[model samples]
Target chain A: MGVNGAYACVVRTKVASTNGGKPMKDTIFIKPGQMAIEDVDKPTIQAPDDVILHIVRTCVCGSDLWNYRGIDATAPHSQNPGHEAIATVDAVGSAITTLIPGDFVIAPFTHGCGHCAACRAGFEGGCLNHDDNFSMGAQAEYMRYQHAEWSLVKIPGQPSDYSEDMLKSLLALADVMATGYHAARVARVKTGDTVVVVGDGAVGLSGVLSAKMRGAKRIIAMSRHEDRAALAREFGATDVVAERGDAGVAKVMALTNGEGADAVLECVGSEQSVDTAVQCGRPGATVGRVGVPHNAKMDLRPLFFRNTQIAGGPASVTTYDKQVLLDAVLRGEINPGKVFTKSFKLDDIDAAYQAMDKREAIKSYVIVD
Target chain B: MGVNGAYACVVRTKVASTNGGKPMKDTIFIKPGQMAIEDVDKPTIQAPDDVILHIVRTCVCGSDLWNYRGIDATAPHSQNPGHEAIATVDAVGSAITTLIPGDFVIAPFTHGCGHCAACRAGFEGGCLNHDDNFSMGAQAEYMRYQHAEWSLVKIPGQPSDYSEDMLKSLLALADVMATGYHAARVARVKTGDTVVVVGDGAVGLSGVLSAKMRGAKRIIAMSRHEDRAALAREFGATDVVAERGDAGVAKVMALTNGEGADAVLECVGSEQSVDTAVQCGRPGATVGRVGVPHNAKMDLRPLFFRNTQIAGGPASVTTYDKQVLLDAVLRGEINPGKVFTKSFKLDDIDAAYQAMDKREAIKSYVIVD
Candidate 1:
């Protein structure tokens, strides 16, 4: 198998222990920028369709930075901080089907009951059965995923054939890549259209790749960071606008011959970012935003007069077929893994968060050992 | 030759007058609820593509009430207020084509140059050559229109075939009807959509008509006014929710079996109206608004999680074919003119404003003699 083979073979065992007779595991949390690794009772399978995953790889997301920066006040303090992850099934509930121990899978950012109306309609992110407090936080060493049959995507190749880089690329499909794909999709990025991706974060970089993959002729990345800009180029960004606000809009307008971009991916959720995205879009174009908005309010007058559309909310990652992106990754057509610039052991997540918080790393991956 | 034949023979003649040798005419303005009729230098055709219109029939718009209520600060004191009108083409500029003096035409609320990229692309409201200040204001005895060929839609049938009611109905097409149609079109109102129109104003009632005309199966007008509610029904609203805000949203949700509405038309630009519109929409639905928003801002968090879209700016009335609505009126398929409950001579414009401001009239007409 591969590096994860041994742990993947471990089957679920009924163990009597403290804390509701469940085994305990380590989970990380953050109170603003301060990190803490605490021992928590391992999540027990409560639903027959639940699967317990031994998280193999998890990463810090741009949204996580929102919490780290204390911008997301609603995010409970000491809340488990990760959502993007790859894991191997360690246990399956009695009613679980189509998955077994040793199977590697991609855990989506949000899980949903396969039977809920929203879930059936492909809006798992808005799942009726979802509970933010109880849902799987992939940052944990052991995580319980509900509706496993519909929530997890199986890795196509055998563990032996999966390269480290390919595995990282597949992990991105769980959140960033899927979210980026959603932004481009909702913005209705058409072939030969010029797309502007606002923000130089991993999600914005992924948007550049997604737009390119979706057949856009030109992809512009708005970035101030040299490293992220270079990475954006590597991900198929044809141009980069380092300026922000009005200057950035002026640059984009000049680039597009004053017609503005055909589509704009608003990866940053600030008022200024939203303003720039709307300002840089041509009339009748759309600005698809996936950023976790922080006190963001769009002034309707400009948006109205411009005749541009704003469409994008929390991405329904499950609505998209993860296999398409995975297939592309497996075929070596794209390298989304480049967004992960550094890696840390699960025990060293504090360093990982610090690296990301200080902008020393484009994104930090936590490898479970 | 037609009802307007008397004015047809008055050919274009340059007459030396008081203010800078321009002809003087009476126009109306308002300082909040107080109205005044003042003598001002009549607008002259300043552009080669301009036309001077003798205002024949003009009506108060729901938007005009915004200025009357002192809600629109930008509306200057003594500023001309009317935008909805049907008029006779009195004079054409040197370069004007496709229209002649005495042709009865519908003056769209906003004018476009007809040949700009935005206008050609069917977003005339965002036309590059558009000048709100220079564009015709229909409250006056005489108004100047630019890009006359594109800005004015000729009244198709002979004036002899037009009844006063039919003429008023055609005038509705200039603003209210066109705006309502634009809202429905942008929300992507399907044939069977259950649309909720939030507002009981003429525009909202017109939205009911427009939605029905666009083949909506069920339209719910959120109105507290008995007359406007009846008018809404007459315009094909299937239901009327007298409640406002959260309760109104609940009523709509209850009506939709708790699934929320398929589409919502936010005709009231207040925060409460926008809130109700967003709250009453089902996931993935759209809230199309045409209200002149006063410091309005949409909270992005709820909209994002709901996966609903908010689209609407100033309606691109030119993007739609006015002839279609005109034909509907001509054939007696619809009676939009019924919204005009009162009329006043141009000399008594104050009473027209008072009637509309006090809700004594659904809409008020100003007859220029």
Candidate 2:
């Protein structure tokens, strides 16, 4: 253990011991009886390319909820779900060059070996490495990371005095916050342009803030809850339209002089939200969507005839834009960390998830000691 | 008309009498009951900015049937319906600069003064000049055209020996053919791209040809009839999916690699065609629609998520890209005029309209002489 952070943390759940009946080695399992908390033997550095990070903070995501609910069964029980975490480098293998022990870092959501074509193209999500996929999920007490130089962003200051809000927000830099920034930037928000954001989730609220920081003349936040809408306003959403779909389009039109908004950010994954985002723009408008879709189909006629364009993809956070966004946050240009509405100790993780699932909290953060 | 080709033959149509039965007046009444063809006192040069054209060749359009059937009840029926014509200049007013007497020309479907700001922006269809508003349809004997320099393109060759096919094809540039070109171009076809042309009428068929000329790799023509499909193939459509809306999209997808087309052109004014065009594109595709939609209610969801774009307007042949298209046709690079499937004398115009309306012919032409 280091200074204020004491004791080595273990993430595995306890199991009943049988007297000499059978010897069992704990391993990650997806059986119905085995929840994500099921104990797995501590993972050691498996290769010279690996660096172990002691996760200091971990955040849950909408996608993690899908895995938990068994909706997105693409990789059933394949691995743990958490992809957003802030940590400190505990150890580096012989080959790891840039990162040393005790360096605080925001781990990339996806890990790349940094030598492949995709990594060269800055798309770590599509990294071609066949041997190293563990650098992605940063949820455990000790997470092994490959390609340490590219996978880690060293927090410039020590963690002892860091504000909980600022530290919790760095979890967003792992994925959600950066994803929203990518969406807004890709939509080409210009000065004096009207921007509409669909979804009032953490990513959406972040987009509202991002659009404002991008100099949008007006930012309209589409939300259902009073609290989220109020947060959106506090984050610089100039208008809020609570309607959905066609009615939402009409509301946007009414506000935009019968012409729709100039840009739209679709941060929700639902089909209805997607449609509303496109319809809430004027001719020659653009919509940037970052929500990972499940089974959404598309129509081209409206987009073509109205001269609207859509641009979106997975958020490549550390791909040349991390410093830009980091500088903005450091200078207080955006306060994306404000989305963390609830906090819990590492011991009460289940309660944090329960609070979030009940819609009682926009986001939850678990701090490690 | 001097030397047949030298003097621009034109035609003019005017109300024979006013609603008040005033004796010979400058302004006349235009009512459905008063649509009798009458010899009005011939038009004299009205302004220094005018050019009197002798109507040499004129043809009817499918939209003309709408007026004759009283479907467009507010369109002022007593006014002529013909907009496609080729003519020769008989006289030029003092302010007429580029156009002179004895020049044969093609008067585009729209009549624009061409000097207004809107016209300057290549939106002659929305010209602001008073006389540019349907001053006279091309079905008459002589036409006094304002803004002659901007509204007319000098005929490339003599009209006397012109084949009926060539003349009919040339006449197409005045409207539908150009509209099809606009639709296809807006759809943004490129090499190795699959395109779906919705609508099998003249404009749609011409769109098939336009897509082919624009290097579309696989042209899927959606038509209801075998004859139109055959014509579409002749015009270079690689495939013909004789279905509508969703089914048509399935057929296109089946032909493509389970992905929809890269481009879709909606040429029919029906909501069905609009939806079908939208459904027939892959993610990040475009659909171009040029039809004047009779009624269109669209869903905007697929556009935002799938990254589809849409753009279109009336065929601004008088002010946009028509010269480039005309040059291509004159060089036989593409022959969209083949859509005219039947012809009739002006006296048999009723039969011509019936033929097209009943689907007995793809398109009908009227020989004014």
Candidate 3:
């Protein structure tokens, strides 16, 4: 078996233990620009419908940098750090109906009650009855997952039945890949469309994969990093626009024969990236955005004049997990796991965050056993 | 023949005239809050692909108030005053291959080249090669029209062949009805959807008609004016909200079982109206905005979290005229003309503006024959 997130193994036990009032060895923590692997009280079922998940593989997300890099203020330190996870149920509450302990699962990061208007409309991320505490970070030995009866998807077999790559791919369905797919889906990318993806992050690369899968004839990925650019091409990018801002728009317009792309994906939320994404749409085109808007103040006036639409938001991971991405991943039809370029043992998660912060890895995967 | 705008008759002659530097009774002019009928040089084919239209009927648009009511600045006085036109082609330039003299037509206000990306994509309102001079005010004896070979829709028969009601319906297709339809179309209003229309203007009433025609199970029209509310109901609104701002949103939510509407049409662009429009959308709902934003400064941040898409712009009248509405009007399936509650003779054009300016009429109709 591959250890430390090359592939994390299956969960088999539930332990009764305490942190002993010290930073032990299993969970991750973050305080502005710094991170650590610490011990925390092992989770138990906290709600009637909740379950305790023994996380198999957990990975760092780009949004984690919002707090870790000081873009968003947080407490002096936070015990919770990651969101994506491929896990096995360790405990179940009385209200659980569909899921059972020891069932391998991909937990949708934003726990959703599938009966809500949003979930029924295919945007489970905006579920009306969501409980925030259900998504306690997955970067630990155990975490509470609510909405298990409706949101969590059971994987087909035990961890040993799949390869390391398949494990990481399943982990991706928890957030990143689903988010990228949302961009393409919302933009209504169609066959023979020329699409522009504005960002070089793992999410943007995943967006390139999504557009190609949706039948876009050409995908132009905006990336300057050699490694990310290569991966973007591997994900089906037909061209790369290394420039940004006005220059980047000019490059896209030139590439599209002065008309701009039929659909544009805005995967980075800064004002610059969003503006660039909007600028790259042809008249009657749409810009699908997935980045958490940290500095975005969009004015709808210009979009109104061009007949361009701005759509998409946080990915409905549960929708994608049960309906699309998981099946594709298991069938080896896609390899989104390549996005996890650096891996660490749970004890070395601080290094995982540091590598991603320094751009040393596209994403950091951590194994907790 | 119908004497004035409840149903203006066909154009029989193309007049060659001199104003003698005096205001005359044929063409309308506006300066600040005042309006007058004036005479100007009669139009002639100005470009190779142009046509001179003998205007039969025209009207005051809600947007005309932007300049008359001082929301938008104007040149001391503007000779051009209206965009909607139901006319007959008086002359065609040498390059006009499809149109002939005396052809009854519905001129799409924003002239479009049928082959441009915007036109091909069904958003001819954003046509790339539009000429400013083509759509000179149609509230006159004649106006110069461009892109005649593509954008102008030829009505099926002579003006006299249709009843007064049919004439009014055909005229509605010029702008008002098509615009409201654009809002519904862009919002993707589907069967069984609950639609919210945010405005009391003629366009909003038309939107009520469109939502119903699109099979929406319930249409909530936000209108406080008793007369407009009655009109909204006649156009198929299932509910009426007589509140503004937050109250309007609240009423909509309650009517929708606290989940909000599946699609919202922002037909008025005041900040409060736009805010109400966005607030009325359920998660995954779309807000289609067609009003020219005089005071709208929409922030996309909140919409991002709700998965609400804000789309739409100027109506692609050419697209709708040629593809759907005109045919429906001809078959007597829809009557968008009831929006014209007040009519005036060409010489009473000032009264037309005054009545609409003071909200005495939903829209003012003028006849020029």
Candidate 4:
């Protein structure tokens, strides 16, 4: 019995660049409101640490609109545009030890190899990769993943029993949902802490859910759109302010007994959003912003004199904390996936972008059916 | 003797309301480089916690220039325009306990009662006050300081042979020197950490001294002028970058093995200064900005992805760490007071402002004599 306990683990079959169906050749890219589906070569395990994932389902993101309009200059050139995906491992490299073919996994929008200092310190999104700049984006048929162990979350079993809505919501654990949580976490929302969320888009809505999970006593969602405000309420917003600037600040103060919210999360990255976030905070409060601003200008005097602290960085979704958040969702503590209100077929990707751009949907997911 | 330690100690003096010379009946305000010296009543303490300081040496600041040009709307309606001053305790109220008449002291720009939560937490600059917005500024002939014990730093007893230069230099501790130290500390300049300091003004020059005291391995001073840059080098700047933007970042990178500096101090609050400070930082580096930014448009994507943290506030000079910094100055570990390059009589105050505005002097002190 002791000898059997020390037996070597059997190796699984590798999907070596060879054992595949006439390798699927399709990739998606977005350009200024239009989606392009073009034929492309299938990706292979390029590095020892990389694993090939056959994308099972992928989704549209609010951030995609920036690249759809060519605003995010640093955005990847043309390979793939999606970051959230549920996938099945199709291949493993010889150097890979933790993953095997046939494992069901969720891929984070941004992946970092597990060994960099940043990754070790739990800031995986800022990993120091010696071989690649853009590691793994999920909008393609087959994606090459770096740091397979850290980047992929193993689903205990096939999630066939889960509804598409449930799966799509879980997809947010890859980025948007995590981004919202990161914003709330950085803002240090505590029990009885008044929170003001700027922006009613997907991340902002998700932020309402996040603040609620963090035990925020009152969450004030600042939005002009009726639909978004309603969605914010559904997601646990205790109050909603439709006004902007001094009027909005007045409304927030009125709701908080003349003291502003203890924390403000700027989910939209605009000059207006930043200014709004700053003005909504009480003295010595913090404002955590995740909006990747196209052209951002922050006046430091208001922030300094009001004793405001601004802290938010790219969400480290692939870090160790992702598992904790995933468990939170499974435990019914939060349903971040509620932000997705629309779904579409992968072949009809163009409609997904159009619907999001026209504000017809808050968030859209594309099923690879 | 044992009971005496537990009992409330008492010290009393009947201080006159005036300095015995015409009551100094002039208050000055500036508008777009224009000075309006108007006759106003000499300021007196109105709150029980307030103590009056007889201004002996007050100096002009780069921040005051913003008020002169009307860029800071929050600037007092009739700006007295000085925040750094050495004064003698002129009067005190019954509620005031620590400060007494005849004590020579340096009054910080803003005052905080030591009992507030913010003061207890060492961020006295964020004190929640019911009486006034900011404690009375240290300009004019007399200042009404709130929270006397917590707001004033008594000067060490003169060795009976202390020189006038030594005293004025000590006065620099009231603001610039302390602020510079605060910025360096917030940036967390470690031993062997490469630090890049933007701006060559009094605060920037003082930052160099502060960095030296913190044991920074390399100090890069960013300045455009030759004289200021030379002064920075003299004050312990190991390298100087005269360029701005990508070129400046490249120079700093080249100096630091292409990784960039570990810490950057942004002493100027403009958008360009903030960006430059962000640009000079390496991954996991920090940027501490103390400038009252006019318009600071910081990009969140880069800041987040690079894992750089930005932290700063109005220097809580008289708070927890002021004494620690002051002791260094007294011990000769730092001589930041050398920054006082010009001095003026109270009648030559206009010339003092002109000199600072024109950048003809780093710092100009107005002596009561």
lDDT of 4 by residue, A1-369 (tens): 000111121121222345453445344443455665655556777778788988877777777666566554222335445667888898988888878898878777656676665565455656666424233346657777776766778765676756776677677787788888878877879998889999899899988988998899999999889988998999899999999877888898789767577889989877777788887876667788777655454445656665577777667676633557878766667777777778877777778878888888888877773
Docking class of 3: medium
DockQ for every model comes to 0.44, 0.09, 0.64, 0.28
Residue pairs clashing, model 4:
A32-A68, A169-A337, A297-B297, A298-B296
Q: Which segments of model 3 are wrong by more than 4 Å? A: A1-30, A131-134, B1-30, B131-134
Number of the predicted model whose lDDT against the real structure is largest:
3
Worst 10 residues of 3 chain B by lDDT: B1-10
Q: For candidate 2, what is the DockQ?
A: 0.09
lDDT of 3: 0.80
What class would a CAPRI assessor give candidate 1's docking? acceptable
| lDDT of each residue in A198-250, candidate 2, tens digit only | 98988899889888878899999999899899999999999999998888889
By descending TM-score, how would the candidates be arranged? Answer: 3, 1, 4, 2
Error in Å for residue B251 of model 2: 1.7
Comparing candidate 2 with candidate 4, which one achieves the higher lDDT?
4
TM-score of 2: 0.58
Candidates' chain B TM-scores in the order shown: 0.90, 0.84, 0.92, 0.88
Q: What interface root-mean-square deviation (Å) does model 1 yield?
A: 2.3
Fnat for candidate 4 (0 to 1): 0.40
Q: What is the lDDT for B60 in model 4?
A: 77
